[model samples]
Target: MAQDYSKKPIEELMAEAKGGNIEAQNALAMLHELGLIPEASAAEAARLYAKSAKAGDPLAALYLGVMHEKGAEGVPVDKSIADSYYHMAEKGGYHKAVDRLTEAGVGRRTILLVDDSASFRNVTRALLNKCGFDVVEAPDASHAIRFLQNGGRADLVISDVEMPNMDGLEMLAIIRGRLQKKDLPVVMLTSVREVGVLKKAKMLGVQGWVLKPYDNDMLVQIVRKALVA
Candidate 1:
């Protein structure tokens, strides 16, 4: 429930937040984010907002989404992270997030990340989160296909080229055949520099390729380019 925070002092709000009051956490976050508090800290506001958001506060989710979307004050602009937060806010019954998502033009831009390595997926997921894209992970091609067959939506696909059962190319071929949506963009990630794989990937409409040891900035640029292209 929303608290009657209009009359509450910052000190009281802080105490309440420390006591694990979700409403107070949201209120203090708003105060700090809006600079209503004396010598406010945007970082602290962001931290509180994250906490409240995790606790299922729609307002906190909305605020965090906007902050990350616009890179407000001390926050870095991360559209993918912003997208995730907006999705959470909308699911939590915040209508404003719907409008914001449309305004950002990425409300439906979900990326399917298929890989076998947990560490690679973790690192890539974090990077994609910062880029403000909603990411869904599938450990291998078969899982990715299952996700698609179950009607999960993905605007783009990033798959590791080599995996057990089905490789990225095989998965893409099967996916294309099953979905009958051949224009869907895909990027390949691989450590192997194989002429045959590259040739087939190109023939199969792979949008881009990134080697295993990718530079963060270059990866971000590649993702951005593929998304736009």
Candidate 2:
């Protein structure tokens, strides 16, 4: 007869965690923090979370921040520690860290409003905020991504077709692929009235397209459509 394995002990799980397995570490941390195991240890969980974060796990840093903020299970609450972990996660290219920091009142809605002309970004940001959106200005795609990585969350993205440091099409592709956002609306505002560009916008799943020298009515309509869709 095969030996019975169903009655496994808790010691095996802790051993796996101590052996440098991140998943096992996270699991044991959760079990201990939640009191599902015999010894509920928030400090132990914090240590495990720190270890995982040092190993480049953004989620671990996020959890560490949350646990520190909450002061779970006799642990001292520390907003500074939480902010540090959040910063680390943001620098690791996690976009949701921006939202987290914003919700925590430690940051703001930084919309990387990418346009070549400073006048354009300023005008667009004013208009967007008037319609209840917070905007951050970015001169190009690389700058926009940098802003995003540093805890910026633009509710909507508006980009011009022509610019240095990556064109609108390339930026759109990166946003769609790497941002991991569902129903993230993008509006392509461009001077280029070429049919090919419009067709490509459709192909790339752009929510709206507007030509340069845009009318206020057109802008409002496109923005409404982008938000609704």
The lDDT leader among the candidates is: 1
Candidates in order, TM-scores: namely 0.54, 0.49
Model 1, TM vs. native: 0.54
Model 2: per-residue Cα lDDT at residue 46 = 84
Tens-place lDDT per residue, model 2, 169-210, is 888887777866546678878787776776676667776667
Regions of model 1 farther than 4 Å from truth: 1-108
lDDT values of the candidates? 0.76, 0.68
Model 2 Cα RMSD, 1 decimal: 16.9
For model 2, the superposed segments whose C-alpha errors exceed 4 Å read 1-111
Show pairs that collide, candidate 1.
79-132, 80-131, 80-132, 80-133, 81-132
Candidate achieving the largest TM-score: 1
